[model samples]
Target: MRSLRKFLYWLNIVGMIAYLIVCGYFQMTGKPLYPGQVGLMFQVASGLVLVSIPLIIEKWAHVALPDILVVLYELFILMAILLGTGMQAYSIPNWDKFEHLFSAGMLAGSGFMIYAARTPADKQDQIDPFLIALFGAAFGVLLGVCWEFYEFTGDSLFGMNMQRYMAAGKPLIGHPVLYDTMGDLLSDFIGSAGMSLYAFFKIRRDHSWLNTFKLHRIK
Candidate 1:
């Protein structure tokens, strides 16, 4: 875990620097960066937050997550840059759908881990795996809804049109808006549901699926 965290630490540093440089270049050249590109700046800020996750957990939550999950999240941070801001997933056909699906799964998994972390060691034997899994799945869906809200806010305030009200380079008319929103929500549901069910069944057999993942520092 330490080794993976170290690697992610440096990787984030380099990626953020390179990303900011590119954004700066676009600004200096007076090239109009897409709203997604403009959003890359915020992604860079978030990368810093991801890099700090370990420290935050160690200090506040005192939860030591598995190296694998830590690594997965670091990769997600990288994904936020490359696939999201750099590759511009929102602009590409079908990429947005894939992003929502993948993100929902990851979020569900993380939410399960967090639920486990909050469990006290003495009471862990009494913990309900099924309930936690359900909560995690619901948490993932909640995040998906919040994300749509974010897109709506962006569209309302800055004309980002992230909600696809202005889709395909033009204002969406008729059922198009409903179609786009529903599609994204559907993708979110598929991903979260799969992860939650897996966790639910797995935990029924192996309680350690959540309890003993080389995490649980507070114990």
Candidate 2:
């Protein structure tokens, strides 16, 4: 598992670097880059920084994140930046919605880990499992809203149309304008609820399972 995790981590980095070079070439050659392509370039660049955050925290704070969580994080970046954006997979119907759902589920799991890590070790098992599940679901939904906010801001400032507020160079109106954002939120909620339900049952069955997902402090 450790070897698999390392392999995936490096693979994502290489993918991001390759995308960056391609984007740079287009820019240098005065070629027109579509909005999605530009967004992909920016996201891939940002991913390099985002992926390093866990290692930085582990090194400086002595809080070691679980290897599975790290692997999932890297995989999410790969899917979103490389496959979804770089490969134009978003052009597929419902692909964006699928990404939102996947992201929410992953975030929900991270929420569970966060709740467990913040609790006192002695009291962890004593805490209500339902509360942990609720926290996970709520955290996922909260972040989903934040993501929508990001898209809205990007569209408002840069005309990125990230929220699908525009079509064919014309601004959408009424229900159509809200469709993409609402669908994304609904998908996110469903994903969060599904993960929370699973967590609740799993925690009730074996409290020790949560330990595998929690961050550990280095001695």
* Per-candidate alpha-carbon RMSD to the true structure: 4.1, 3.1
Please list the residue runs of candidate 2 whose C-alpha ends up more than 4 Å from where it truly belongs after superposition.
1-4, 18-46
lDDT of 2 by residue, 1-219 (tens): 568778887887887898789877887677835555676788778888876777788899998787766776777667777777776778888888877777888888889888877887788789788988899999999999999999999988887989998889999888899999999999899989888898899898887778867887898
lDDT, model 1: 0.73
The stretch of ten residues in a row with the least summed lDDT in candidate 1 is: 210-219
> How many backbone clashes does every candidate have?
0, 0
- Give me the displacement of residue 17 in model 2, in angstroms: 3.7
lDDT of 2: 0.82
How much lDDT does each candidate structure score?
0.73, 0.82
Quick one: how many clashes does candidate 2 have? Answer: 0
**Which residue pairs clash within candidate 1?**
none
- Error (Å) of candidate 2 at residue 90 is 2.1
* TM-score, model 2 to reference: 0.81
TM agreement with the true structure for every prediction: 0.70, 0.81
